[model samples]
Target: MESPDHPLAAQCLQTLPKIELHRHLEGSLRISTLRQIARQHNLPFPSNADLPALVQIQAGEPLTFANFLSKFQPLRQFYQSPQIITRVVEEVIADAAADQVRHLELRFTPAALARAQGFPLNEVMDWVIESARRAASQRGLSLALIASFNRHEPLELARQVTALSADRAGSGIDGLDLAGNEAEFSALPFAGLLREAKQSGLRLTIHAGEWGGAANVREAIQDLNADRIGHGVRVLEDSSATALARERQITFEVCVTSNVQSGVCPSVLAHPIRGMLAAGLNATFNTDDPSISNIDLTHEYRLAVQELQLTLAQLKDRVLAAARASFLPPAKRQTLCDSLEIELAQQIST
Candidate 1:
């Protein structure tokens, strides 16, 4: 089980100046805001007292993928308008800023957003992009939007999202990610589009090996050419798979809490991030879905130290590693690395 949150300790750990690379915009929606939207749209959701259980993983729930995936179903109903879409993006960013998350790469599926209201794909992308551009600026946060495609969706939908991402690369979109239903779907269907995304100058990240196995991790690296692997804790299941990732030096955006909640890991204590590090693999801590798991980056940092037995020094190393692995271009990436180095130097074993 995870430990109780220490608010003050979290304040100090905030000096990682926190860089988060794997958070999902959809999964990051505010529960209270969801309630407001529910009332406004007359969406048939549970009353306020019971809403969290519907959209969030409750204690003692079966920690299985199907149970975890079901949480998003109620959420899908709330994106009923463009104002609602933009409001969610802005609030998610604002929440990140409040957490002292200085650098965040928020990945969102346009198809999911568009599907809810029958909004056009490009319109959904623009709503997110424009809102993110404005929100990050107002908050003085370094935020990037990753237009993610669900692997289970039609390959044509993926292509349309990729093309839109490529067209708006520099403006607000900085990366593309393949997310969703990794258990049943293969990344192969969207491989060519991902490769084309890379050529179009959009960085690639693929969700693999969390619900599936380590072979998916290998596939993400070799086939999809992922710049980073999302929740690749299962990569240790296969030695050759582990070796391939180590050789490529692929960054694994390891989400400690989400893995436990989703049953990817048996529990937080059993997360393989430390083992991944020992094997010379590059790993970074991230909140896969802060709202869904009822956790923030601070909660994850606390776990990294107290439960995972990571020294604050090692925690700092992971933050820098995430910064180095960010999809930002050479100049901005170096600047982020430089700034994090200065801030992380302020913390010590506590």
Candidate 2:
């Protein structure tokens, strides 16, 4: 059993003001909340005790993409109503605040949230935005939303999501993210749509180089015009891709445990985050699917120090790097970076 009190390292990591740029709302649902929803809605699933095994990765389970993706199947049943959607969004923000994440760009798939109950896409987006705003205001956390499109899904669906996101960009939606199976489905078909999304005043972050290869990262930068690359840990596999990333100063949102759990890396220690950092790539730590992976940004930071052998100073720099790499507009991004610098300096001095 875990101790009641956090260890010194955990405590230290929790105190740092963090930024999470690659978190998915669908994957961040609390197990406790899921259980409550399951019981209240009478969904077809096991009892509360057995629910975690379905939605969360287990210790002995095969850590493959198929196994990891299977968890979300059971999750879709829980988004049964607008009220449930709003509640989950509020809880996600509350959980992030509790984890000491000062700024968060939460990405959500409209298709996943809407498909379960056949809710209209616009209404779903509205509920998420409203709930996020309420939660952020209540907890004093800076929050933003990113609309995510799946590669395996139809292009027409992608087009619809892009249109909705672009229409709502000024309200609270900050960016567009390409997320889904990168191994079988190619990102090529949606390149024009993503480029148009960028031109429509929405920022872009492509999920590439995890299930795919380093060349996908190059395509994301050159073709899709992504402002950032999600899980581009494989960029080091190609020297040219690494050089291009460096030249473009593209930020790589590195989710260490997610990669290991998804079979992208052999183990936590074998993760290329260290190599990405050493190669002068602007790499930042994130918890891609916090609840699904049973982690938070604090856990990722601690893992960086313990497993990846990152010094406290180096970890601090990466925290700042995440702030700088945020999808916020220029002035707001700078303000966030400056505020974090002051708080981080104070923490280090103490």
Q: After superposing candidate 2, which stretches have Cα over 4 Å from the reference?
A: 1-9
Record all residue pairs in model 1 with backbone atoms less than 3 Å apart, i.e. clashing. Answer: none
For model 2, residues 154-264, the per-residue Cα lDDT tens digits are 999999999999998778789999988888888989988987887888999999999999999999999888889999999999999999999999999999999999888
Predicted candidate 1 versus true structure: per-residue lDDT over 1-350, tens digit per residue: 12223555556766458999999988999989999999998988778999999999998899988898899888888889999999999999999998888899999988788887799989888989889889999999887789898888888888899999999988779999998888898889888899889998999898898999999999999888999999899999999999999999999999999998888889888889889999999999999889999999988998998788877767888888999999888999999899878877765442
- Best candidate, TM-score: 2
Candidate 1: Cα lDDT at 63: 94
Compared with the true structure, the alpha-carbon lDDT of candidate 2 equals 0.90
lDDT values for all models: 0.88, 0.90
Root-mean-square deviation of candidate 1: 2.6
- At residue 338, give the lDDT of candidate 2: 93
TM-score for each model = 0.96, 0.97
